[model samples]
Every structure is written in structure tokens, then in C-alpha cells.
Target: MEFNIPGIVNAAIPTRQDRNRNVMIISSNSGGSYNDSGFLSSDFPHSPAKLYITAESDSFDAQTLRDWRDEGFNVEYLPLGDGGSAYAARLESLAKSNNLGPCQSYGIIAYGDAASFCLEHFHVVDNNPEFKLGCLVAYYPARIPDPRGKFPSPVRAIVHLAAKGEDSIDVVGHSQMLGIQGSRRVSRRRLDRGVGAGRALDMAYPAYRYDAEPGFAEHDLDEYDRVSAELAWSRSLAVVRRALMGYMDADASVVDQNTDGKFVTRNLSQTMGTYTAHRSPHVTYMPTLTGAIDSQELQRFYSEYFLNKNPPSTELTLVSRTVGSDRVVDELHVSFKHTQEMPWILPGLPPTNKRVEVMVVSIVTLKAGKICHEHVYWDQASVLMQVGLLDPKMIPQKASERGVKKLPIVGREAARRVLQGFEDEEDGEADNELIPGWYDDEEEEEEKDEQEGKKENTGKKTKLQEEKGKQPEKASVGPETRDEDGQAETIPERAKSEPKEVEA
Candidate 1:
């Protein structure tokens, strides 16, 4: 799909190319004034195909709508007071009045924050299966701000571009997943489960509290740049255009606020400011000691521990969920387990570098093919507490209170080294304890076979007797095996049963 955006006026832009194929551009309005600098009107998309569906003046980016009429594109700017959510309904009514053909493929290019409303209510107006979607552009579309009910709309191809960010915290470990990369693409399933968009990553901004002070200006891009250039989110307009049009996935949250455990149905009118402190990937980590960890670092940790070692005898198990979508509206939850190690995190100390078995669960949400929210869980704080932080009490005040376990960056190397040393010591004593059991089983089987041969030579075999003899083994009962010559094989008493395990 080709997109040509000159600037943004409010959240809507103009598309003025009227050669052959005409694009149905719809703009939702909220009565915001359009700026001459950031508005897209005069120069529409380079393609010679465009149309505009706009709403009233004074109550929206009305000034920009006037320019569309002069540009010679088919301009049908209506007054929302004249037609509310029923605007599309009215369009349909008009189409029914006039004999219109499906020859004109349709597309939606939303400016300012009007795009969110359009996405929120797509299923309501145009429900025809024939109208899959030409393209959808939501520039600066705000997140779903409510948690009451849902307004579901899914276009085959949709793009959402936002200027702000959100924060996260829960049962997961403590760490911020920052973002400010040019842009990213996420799927719809991930919108519900939660993850990250590849583009806007490691940004410095934090989530603004729903109820911050009145003077907090949401437009502080300059201040952010001055404070830390890395934190600035003002990417080139062209880059943002690509970011918003990358995909049509629905794995993203409609609401930008906390998407869990509360009013999850509320939609916001606009974002007040940036949201920081992303949810760490440890929100759902819980399982047996032999489970798997799937992070890149965790895999490397195991390579250093078992695979690269001389004999490669250190058994490693890792449990993890593949990284995926984190959209609010539609999301996907994926989980897996294997044996591995963390060279940087120790089970009992801060992991500077060590490999150990672990489990991970990640929930990601995606919108327009980009991650909107992500939650993760792991075992870090407990390890540090076990090895000892500067002060167990101060290790991670919030994490400790919630019983979260994670290793901090400061003392990670020492803790991992200590854990590796501990592992080496434990692996050394199992030689005689585990290997002999296999040999003993073989010897016992041979003795039993000899006894069976002798019994066969002495007496006639009975069907009932044969079944009775086999029943004991089948039922896993009457344990001790002895030779027909009358001798019980010595059982190795090293180790036996293990404790039960669980996960979150």
C-alpha cells in the first residue's frame, strides 16, 4: 500500500488524487483546531485516487476539511450533529438512493485522534463481508481508555500510530521495557496477551497516571529531548507513516491505561502524557526446577554451562513462551518448556552470569500489527534474596512485598558464578548413586529369566498362574525382584521419588 502524507492537521489528513481509482477517506472529528505546520491537506497522496468523508466545523478539525473541497477531490464533509455514529449509515442510505457500483475500492485515513473512534466502531456501520479493507490509517489514534464493554471492529489492513507510551507492573519482575524506536509492527492476538512492537522500543517516557496534576502538559517533546535525547518520541513524519501502515493485525489494546484487574472497558478522549515503566517479561513465570527459559540471554547461559563444557553432562531445563503480540482488543497467549540455564542470573544469588533451569510466561497485546502491552514473570528476586542483596529488606521493596524474585544488574556476575560453583559440587556426587541402578535392573531381569526357564522345566504352566504372575508387575506392586535360585538383588539407595511441582 502506498501512502503520501504531507502533514497532520488535528488527527486527520487530506488525500487529494482524483485520476482513476478513488479512495474513500473518512475523517472522525472532535472539534480540535488544525495547525498549518503539522496538517496534511494541500498535497494529498501521490496516487491519482482519493475522496474525503469529513464532519462538522467548530467542533473538530473543521478548518482542514474546507481545504479538501478546494483541492477538487470528492468532498462529503458532514456535520456530526447531523449524523452521529450513524454517519456511515447515512452514507449507505445515500448510496442506496443513487445507483453506485462497488467499482470504487475504499480506504480510511484518520487524522488526529479520530481514528480510534473509527476502529472502535467499524463492525457497527459497514458489516458487509465484501468490503474487506483497502487500507486503514489511524494517525495519533488514542488507546482504548475504558474497561466497561467492547466496541469491536477489525479491518483486514489497519495501522495505528501513537505519540505517547504506557507503563506496567504486576506479579512480574521489576524492569522497564522502554521504547522510542522509529516504529514497530504487532498482530491482533498479541493486543490481548501483550508484548512489544519491534520499532518503538526502549523509549524513556513513562505512563502518565490517569489523575496527574493539572499543569502536566502532554506535549513535552522538546523538554523530553533536552532531558534525554534518547527519550524523545518525535520521529520523522515519514517514519511514523510507515510505522502506522505496516500491518492489519488486531493484537493491541484499545485502552492505553492498565489493561488488567479493573475497569478495562473505558476509552479515553485523549492521552494526557507519556506512560513509562513497561511490564517486565516475568508476569507469568512459575513452574518446576526443570522447566525452560526462552529468552536470548537464557539460551546463551545454557550454551556456556552444559553444551560448551568438556563432557556436556549438566542437565538443563528451560520453560518459556515465545515472544508474540500484545494488543488489547485481540491477544494470543503462548507457552513452552525445555531445560536451559541463565549465565547472568543465579538461583541463589544475583546472576552476573550462570545457567539454571527456569520457567517464563508472557502475555502480549497487539494493535494494527504492533505490540501495545506485555507482561512477563520469572525467578529473580528470590535468588537475590537467597544469595543476599545489599540489604534483603531493601533488595526491591515492592518486589519483596509481593514475593517477586529477580536479580538486579549490580551484583549479577558474582551470584551466577556462585550458583555455577554450587552446581559443580552437586553434580560430582551422583556417579555411583545413579548409574548402578541400570545395571542392577539388567542383572535382576536375567535372574528372573533363568527362574522362569527352570519353572517351565519343572511344572506345567497354567493360564491363571501366568496372569497372576504378570499382574504384580502390571499393577506396579510387590516390588522386590529375586532370582529363582533364591537371592534378592541389592537396591541402590541413592535417591528415589521427587516432590510435586506447580506453575502459574
Candidate 2:
């Protein structure tokens, strides 16, 4: 009989958004698309926040906007012609838009010069309660507000600064300078109350400093750093989520369903159904660079090279599992016999019929209750050693000359040690076996002490025998003789058996 999982085999329908929170993205760039911004529309496609792009002109990359809409966001573009009264009036009108309820508020995300303007005029929202401003995020603004001044209650704010230049704000009356290498120096001034002052007062709001230049978080910019951009994205998302109360808990059951389809059930369609339908999902087996990106590629890889390629005796034991807000991390001990050709772990290698054991860590990130990406990691050297593909003793000549005899890779013992540790068993394996002369000094001292004790006991026995006038018994020699089958050799005379004395 065949059975299908509810959320795994079918995507969940989105709930209606009657009171969705609003977010305004203000860009300083005059005539560019949403792609020019540091944020990706696809990232927040299924978010419970309504996104609005306020720019100088309504002209934007049409394809980019369409992509955002396809991702399930009600995105709109509003034009802010000139600055001064007209811009403020337009913003005020948005604050009074019928889309927002009496209890709802909106957030602002500004960049460059527009960020500076928002920071300078943040008081407009603070003084007016009807503006209903929730939070403000500024990225690489030309100027920043005084660090000691705090924003009013119920309004959260954060700043992301570029590490390539100086800021207008001063710390403890000293100018704040941001170095190209992301070095920060602050001079603290002692207050009259014996209190240390500087960062403590300057931390009126959360400020993040990135080691990259301006536009590092933007995907389309030349200065974009994926690492920095990702870090910033997480922080920004956290702030927005907290302020707007827009938290989405990822469903861990979807991951379990995917795992069952891949390893146990060996069903391709069910495995593909566990991934997000809103965007392209990906999986990466970091050891062999296997797996694929997007639904089509992933389906092909799983069907041909992964799902059915495992040995029938495969076993997986979960070592540890960590459930986070949007991801799950699992440490697993996997064991299987190399009974057939397995392409995911050992590609293009014939079956050696060897039992292999290794530890694998998988990180699965989910979006909208579906898997977005998965990254699996394991020790490849240990796998190769267990499979007989790698010999530790076969090292380069240079390594031999350096007194290195064998590589430090262990076969199944690596997995055994982890399992032992997980089970809280007494450690049976010794450590640092690869280090030369690890036990040389202790073993040599033990042998030397044993030899000295034997000598002392022999001397004591000889002294006692002499003092007591007692001679030790003479050593006896046994005859070396063999009896033939059905016959016995004649015994030699007793006198002939004694040794004859010679006249030396």
C-alpha cells in the first residue's frame, strides 16, 4: 500500500492577509530598479509584510517587480518627485493610507542620501503619533544622528555603516573614523560620577559595521560581498520581524519527510515536493560537490544518482539535532556496506564490499514551511580510508624526509569515537597516537626499573645462600632423545653420560 504525507506531498495554501504590516524602501538612486537595492524581493516574497518602493521616478526594472509579485508579495512603486514639503506630504499621506489599521504601523528602509535625510528628520515621526512609525533601518548614510541621543519610545532604529570612510558623529568629543580594514578606535572620557563613558552612551541604537565598502550588501553592485550581505540580511530581517511581529516558524516535519523520501522510501516525487514551491530550492553535499540547485536539477540528480543508489543495508543514527527559527541542524552517524555503486559519496568507484561508517552534519533552511536549501558535510578523507581508496603510508617523499610516516586519517575508528562520546561510554581509544615519541620516555623508565629490581633480588639471594652455608642445587640437563615407531633406542651407560675431565 502507498501513503502520502499531507504537507510534504502537497504545498500549503497561504493565509489571507487582511492586516499585513507595511514596509517602505527609500532609495537615493534616481532612476534604478528594485534590483539596484541591497535587498532581494524574492527573499521576502512570502513574508507577512507589504513592501512599498518610494523613489524619484516610477520607472523600474519591470521584470524585477514581476518577479516580486510572483513570489506572493503585494509590491507597489510610489513616486516622490522633489524633496522638502512635497516629499513629507506624500509620506504623511502614506501614513494615513486606508490599508493600515488604527493599531498598525509601518517601517522605513533608506539608503545613502535618503538614509541621511530620514535620520536627520526622524523627529517628524517622533513628534507626531499619527505617523505610526514602527522602525527605521539606514544603510551607509552620508551622516548619522548624534549617538548619545535616543529615539522615542515604541520606535526602533538601527544603522549599517561602511568601514571604508569617516562618520560625522563624534564619540567622547573625538571624531569617529572608520578604517578601510574595518578598524574602529574610540576614546573614552571619564564622567564626574566615576563612570566610564563612550560606547555605553553611544549605543542608543544597534549599529553594525561591515568590513566592505559602500554597496556591499547590494546584489547588483560591483562591491557586493556575499558574506557581508548575508550577515546584514539576517540582522535586518530580525529587526523587521521583531518590530512588525512577523515571525514565521519553520516546520521541521517537512525536513523529516524529505529525509524519509530520500533515504528510506526512495521516492523522487515525494522528495521534490518537500522543497519550497515559491522559489528555486537547492541542496549541496559539500564533500563530493554532489546534489543540485533548483527543482528540475534536484529532481534529475536524485532520480538518477542519489535516491536509488544507496546500499540496502544502509543505517542512519541521529547523534544530535538542533531546531532553530528557520532551520534545522542534524549530526548523524551513517553506516553502510559498499555492496553496490554509490555515486553520492564515492563516485566512479567499483564496489569493494567494505563496511563504511562516517559522521555527517546536515543544515536545512526552510521558507514558508518548505525546504529552501540544504548543506551536508562529512569527512571525505575518512570515507576514502574506509573504502581502501586512500593509503596513509603512501605519502610524498618530502613528507617522509620530514619524519612523517603516515597520514593522520583514521577509518571507521573516527565514527566509533564520536558514537562512544555521544553514548557517554568510557573512551577506549588513546589520543595523540600520530605524535612521534608520545610514550617513549614512560616505557623506557619502566623497563629500566624492572631490570634494576631483578639485579637487586639476585644479589640478595646469593648473599643469603653464602651466609647460611647452603649451596644451591646443581642445574640438571635433560637427554635429547626420540623413539621411533614400533622400536625403542638402547639407553647409553651412566658413566658415558658424565662429562670427562681434561688435563688442561
Candidate 3:
């Protein structure tokens, strides 16, 4: 922080542009001051894009520079010892003055204090319509904090990749940055759900904790790096690069996290990357990731990121909760010491005495990486505790007189549900049912309108004719295969068939 970061940026000579567009990359993470070329050569977003990167490290005339030149981007290097602010201001002036290809872009990516280097220019980029400021991808962004407990900047349409676990601990020093309910955040690996590598990054996860059943029938996640894949180093890079590209252009869509084999229409963010367009009890709505967001929409995103608070806004409501992960072989072998939620009342087993740890770990095995065969090892009890569903003492409870202070604190909005058995237990529902991709409210409305239009086109068919009509000719339809929750999704828009009476 003592160095003139911008000053370092100022000294780098602009590379000659064969193409008009350019990407400006700044490498400065709390890990240590690195140079314009900080990430390892193999890191996904490292090269391939033609642009300039200024980092906090000592840049040597080496192969990386050669490799960058090979890719067509003009390479520039700067040392942090320069005039920080003046340097940064000058760089900003230079970037503003530079022109990219018609589709070319301007960007600044940071992992350390260097991430702050671009904050001053976010609003500036937003105003310049011609020069599309592509996505600002920040990894473990540091130093900036808001009084309301969220990221400080108004990141308009920027795709954020926040790596949890290093809240206060920087590269060398123990500087406190973000907090949780007035307390400085600390790294508790047992509680962290991080991969086996102790120093790896851990995402805060979603409202529904990921549960991977412990048998080989499920995936063996040796590295839970949060790439939506299991040990998929290459796939992780692919997705990160895709996001970086989308941030630069006007239209870019995130790959479907569930399956890379196919693509969905939705442009994705982190929360939506996993939950896009899926229908289910857990995710209530699909908020638009592309529109201009107001303060309220920003709040909803923050709440989902912070405490998982949802609703009361035009933006999609998310019942946010962390998605759990464990990639190391021995990392998750340790038992759950305590899941932090104070006794939360699960719907079915309200009055029971089953204080438990959540292990619906099946959901933990995402698709951006390899997936193990699950749907078989999912256990109800293990999942209940992980989600703070059935408290230990309340699994099968009666009116045991525990002091009010001793009881678990479930908020006032909820009136207590007395003990009851599972709602879909005997009826047969998977623990975490994969909400079908076709089940969004918006889709339903669109379907309804389409159906009404079809009815008008065909004119009125009688009740029997409509009910027992010939199969409405449609495309080659398929049956429901297993979805995320191991349940069959109700096929949307399946063509109807008629009943032909057979001779007795």
C-alpha cells in the first residue's frame, strides 16, 4: 500500500495495437505484490487475450513477456516504487485515451489492493457508451469495505468472483477487512468447507448447503476450488475466461454450471450460475442478471451474499445459503463439530429431537467439474443437521421444560410448527430435489401465452377432442432423466396423445 501503484501503471509504454480493442490487467492481491504478469503461466485467464497487465511485482524480460507478445497484446511492465496516485491517474488517462477494436474493451482486474486501483474509474467507464468497459473480474478483492458490510463500489454489471477465507489475513500481514455481525472474520477450516489444500479459496456458498454422500457412488472431490467441477483445473480456467470476455462485450452468457455439454440462454452471475432457471422449493425465482440495478436490487444481492435475506424487491428473491464443498480426500473425514445456525425449525420435524449436521453432500458435487454417481447415498438425517433443520434435542421432543435462554433462537416471523413427520417422506421425494429448468414463473407465463395463441390458431376443439386429441405433433420429445435432486422433472410442453379404443 505504501507504493504509488498508479505511478507504476504510468511508466508502462502502451503496446502497439493491431486490433483497436485492449484489455488492461492490474495484478495486486493481498497475497504479495506481483507484477503485471502475476498468475502462473497455466492459470486460465493468464494469457490468450491481447492486452496490457501492470502488477506490483518486478517484471523481468522473460518468456511470459514473449508468450504475451505471441498472443498479439502489447506487454507493459511497471514497478510499485513509482508515484502511486500520480502513476495511477496517468494510467487511467492513458487507458481512456487508448482505443480498442469495435468490440475491443477496457478492463482492470485485481486480487489485492491493486483491485482498488480501478474503483476510481468504474463510474467513468460506465458513462462512456462507445468504449464498452468489459467485466471487472476481481479475485479475493481487498482493502475496500462498506459501512453496510458489502463491497464498497457500485459494480454496474461486473461479474464478481469473491474468494472467501482471507477476510482479514493478507499475504504477509494480519489486516482485518470484512466482518460478520460486528466480528472480524476468521478462517475456521472445520467450518470453512474449503478444499484439502489449506491455503485454497472457499466461496460462501448458497442458501442450500451442498451435500455429497460419502460413498464412491458419489463424486470424489479431492479439490473443492468452487469451479462447479470436481478437480477440474482446466474447466475452471475456461469459465473464468468466459466471464472475463462477457464483462467486456455487450452480450455474453455464462456456461450452464450444471452441464457444460449444453448452453442455456441466461447470462450468469455466481448465485445464478448454479441456480439458473431451475424450478424447486429451495430457489423461488430467477432474477435478471442483465438489467440496470438500482440500490434496492443491489441490497438484495448483498443480503443474499451476506445473510441470505430475500424478497421485498423487484429483483429476484433468493433464500441465500452457503453451498458446502470438500475436495481433499481427508478434509471432510473430520466430523461436524457444530453447524453455526442456532436451532432452526425444519418444516417436517418441527417438534423432534434430531439436532444434526447437514450432509446432503450430494448437491456438493457440481458439474463444472466431474460428478460422482449420487442419488443413491443421500441420507435424510445427515442433511437435516447441516441445514440447521432439526436441532439435536428437538428431533423427537415433547414438552421438556428448558429455560427460554437455553432454547434455540428462531426469529419471530416464524410461528413454531409442532412435531410432524416428513411432508414427502412416505410420498417419496429426494432430499434436495433438482428444481426443473423449465419451472420459472416467467417461463410459465410465456407458455400460457403461447398456449392461448395456439388455441386461437386451431379454433375450438370439443372437450373430448381436446382431452383425447391425437398427439399434437411436436419435436422428438424425451422422458425425464435424473435432475440435480434425483427426482424426475415434470416435462414441460410435452405433446399430447389420443386414446384409441381396441376391439374386445
Candidate 4:
């Protein structure tokens, strides 16, 4: 929460009274060096509560600290040589210092050896009520604390364990150490019962196992797994926020406002205003590879290509939405008539005067309560098929040399199924119509039409040959003509004598 350097002059260091809480990160590098110049810059002028402590002779990734800063924390670095008794003394001095506000709380995140040290010596803060240590997060520690050991009130703890490589810990053994049967999967209930018997123990302490090697949560590491990292990040963030900030939720209004601006109001400025001012925002339409990066390009896209290009009959219905700490995901069903050239969705295509329907998914990430980036996804094949540009029946089959055949692409039925739901089988549209022999009736009708066409051509040829031998009689044209309904129709003799209308 607060710290006092014993040997250094008090006047040399400026005090940060504005920040009430602090987060101290103790890394594993034994010889890591630290610099405070970047942390004191004008970029982060808001909070001075976060600290990164490392050794004085080693080098580490600076991007890791910058990432924490991007998450709205003011980060600082401290260098301590070797890190043993001196480190413990420094932590003691910080706990005793009066610089922090009375109501403020601080948390710690430790890595590797430092994490092991924190887990072993956690009682330094857990035993003292005056120390304002709220939570502790350990990543891939060499040793774990006793599972049956209880952490007293006002001190919460969690540990992340790697599942593979040398860094992996024996989780089953640990569960057995707590007097439970050794199983491949650790039971939360049994662990809770084992640890929550005493009044001093905290029942909510969590230990998560990631199916990756150590350093999976760090962004700059070679073994970094985004899926694992994100999952762990959400969990760790939830613990820290619960301890310090009482669970602040991500706001969905920003995304809603941005959507309204783009679809309803069609205001370029209003849409752009929803993005974060702190960084350059980007948007990507994944299907057509049409999107904009930064303010100027985005404005140009909205004005010249997107906002005015949508047809008047365009309609968007929200199917579902999921909101997280810093992002929003929306599933939308969009329908429109192909009455105008839409550069965003149907680039370089003329209006086919056909109705189009498709399902779209948009993922919007936010920073500082504003949009940071957007990823829009939709099935382009279904869009093309709905507008009559793509013919599934004419598509070539790649598996065989059977020149050409049908593809599995669908038309408006895909969107219809999504909107109407798939539970009602009887009322739902037919399935697997494109599979061979699935629709035998249609195949029989095609064969019948082909036979009728060959017979008509033979009759015409025979009649021409007969006329050739005669007195050069005028050859009659086909007896059949296609009517408006696309059916064969024979012209009557009375109708042939009728006069045609002239345009003049």
C-alpha cells in the first residue's frame, strides 16, 4: 500500500497522494534491472498505484508493464539486488509506511521464485490487520503452500499452475495432501471442505490449472497462449477487482451507441466518437476484406462507401449479445434488398433487385470506456447466393473429375433458420437437399424435360428435310414458345393472325 526507503533521502522522491491503491508485481528474474523513466512519463498521468519490482542486474520485457498500463493502471518499477532479507525488509517498511490512505488496499502479483517466496511468507500480511494487503496472485511458483493451511480474513489468494513441462505441479498429489483421494481431476467441493473447516480460512481461494507450459499468461513469452492467457486474465482481474474495486462491469452503452450511429442515424462523427481517443482505432470486415484503420481512413469509408450505400429496405435485428469486462459481442440478422451497390458487403456488384439475408457477428473491444477495435464477420457465399450471383448447381466438384456439380452453399434459408430457430423440425425447411438422391423428384423432372427437348429438336429437323424435297416451301418455326410462367405453349392459328401493338 505504501513504502518508505530507509537510506534514500525523503525529499528526493515525490509522493503520489492521488492514488489510494497499489499493485506490486514481483518477477522471477534474479538479475533483472529496473528503470522508472518510462513509468513517470506524461502518457500515464492518472494513477501511480501499480509497481513492478525486479532484480538490479537482469533485463526483461518492458511490453509486459506497458500492457498493465493500457489496462488503466499507473505502473512503476523498483530494483532490489538478489531479493531475500532485504526484499522482506523493504516489504515490511512499505507495510508500516503511512503514505497510503487509511481506507486504501493493495494487491501483489508474483512470478516463479518470487511467487514461491510470496506463498511461503504470505503470513507477513495475512497476520497483520494494519497491513492493507487485500489479495495475492502467484504464477507458476516452484513450490505451493500447504493446501490445508488457512489464510485468515481480509487476505485472498490464488495460484495459476501449468499443466505440462518441468514447471507443472502435482495437483493430484496436492489434492491428496489435503486428505482427499488422489484423482486426475481435483474436486472443488472436496478442496473447499478440506480448506474451509477453520474459521480463519478463506473459502473462496482459487487455484486454476492451464493446459500449457509456464509463462502462458505473459504476452511477450514464446509459450504465450492467447486462449489460456485470456481465461487466466479474466479470472485474475476478477479477483483483483473484487478485492480493490468491488467488481466494476464493462459498459455496453458505448457499443449500442456506436451501432445506432452506424445503422440508424448514419452519422460519421457520432460513430467515430465512440472509439477511444487514447489510441488509433481499427475496424475489419472479415468477409470482403473491406475496412478502415485510424481516423482518416475510417471517416472516408463511412462517408464515401458505407453510410449512404445501404438500401432503404435494409433491416438489422439483434439475435443475441454478450458483454465482458472490455469487449462486446453481437449476433445480428441482417436483411436488405439489392437495390444499391454496397461497397462494404457487395463491392463492385450492380443491383440485382433481389432480396438478401445473412447472419452477421460483430466483436467490439473497448479501452477506457470507448471502442478500441471491431471485427465483423459474415458468410460471403450465402450473401452472393441470395443475390443470384452464385449458382450452387454449377459449382465444380473438387473430389472427382465429374466436370461440374452442386456445392453445399445455401441461400436465404440459412438466415431464415437462424431467425426462426431450429427446434421445430416439421415446420423447418428441408435438410440435405444438395446430397445425392436426397431430392429424387427434382432429378426425375430434369430428366423428363431433357427427353422432351431432344424429341422436339428431332421433329423440327425431320420437317426441314421434308420441305427441302418439296417446292421450296417456307419452313415453319417451332410450334412451342415459352409463356410468361416459363411453361411450353403452342400458338393458335387465330392468335397468329392477330396484329401486334406498335411502340409508336
What is the TM-score of candidate 1?
0.24
Name the lDDT value of residue 97 in candidate 4.
Answer: 59
Deviation (Å) of 166 in candidate 3: 8.6
**Deviating ranges (above 4 Å) for candidate 1:** 1-113, 116-323, 326-343, 346-356, 360-377, 381-504
- On the 0 to 100 scale, the lDDT of residue 214 in model 2 is 73
The CA-based lDDT of model 3 is what? 0.31
Which model is ahead, 1 or 3, in terms of TM-score?
Answer: 3
lDDT digits (tens) for residues 1-504 of candidate 1: 522222222124233221111222232332312211113443433221233333333243433333333322343443434434476464334433433233222334443334444443342222322332323433343443122212221232233233333332111011112311111222221122122432332211111121122111223322222211111111211222222223223322332333221112221211111111121111122322321233333333333442232112232222222322222221212111112333323232222322222232344433223332335445554333333343333546777676645323322233333334446865323224223355787789999999999988776644545645431112123456744322244544444343222221
Mark the 10 consecutive residues where model 1 has the least summed lDDT: 171-180
Q: Per-residue alpha-carbon lDDT of model 3 for 43-71, expressed as tens digits?
A: 43433343444444555334434433432
Model 3 CA RMSD to the hidden true structure, in angstroms:
23.6
lDDT per residue as tens, model 4, 193-306: 223311122323467666678778776689888777766665666566555544545789999899888888999989889987767788999999998999888889998999
The per-candidate count of clashes, in order, stands at 122, 0, 60, 4
For each candidate in turn, the TM-score is 0.24, 0.65, 0.26, 0.61
Q: After superposition, how far is residue 74 of candidate 3 from its true place, in Å?
A: 9.1
Arranged by lDDT with the best first, the candidates are 4, 2, 3, 1
Tell me the tens digit of each residue's lDDT in model 2 across 124-152: 22233353556677777656654554554
- In model 4, residue pairs whose N, Cα or C atoms come closer than 3 Å (at least 3 residues apart or on different chains), thus clashing, are 31-57, 31-58, 32-55, 32-58
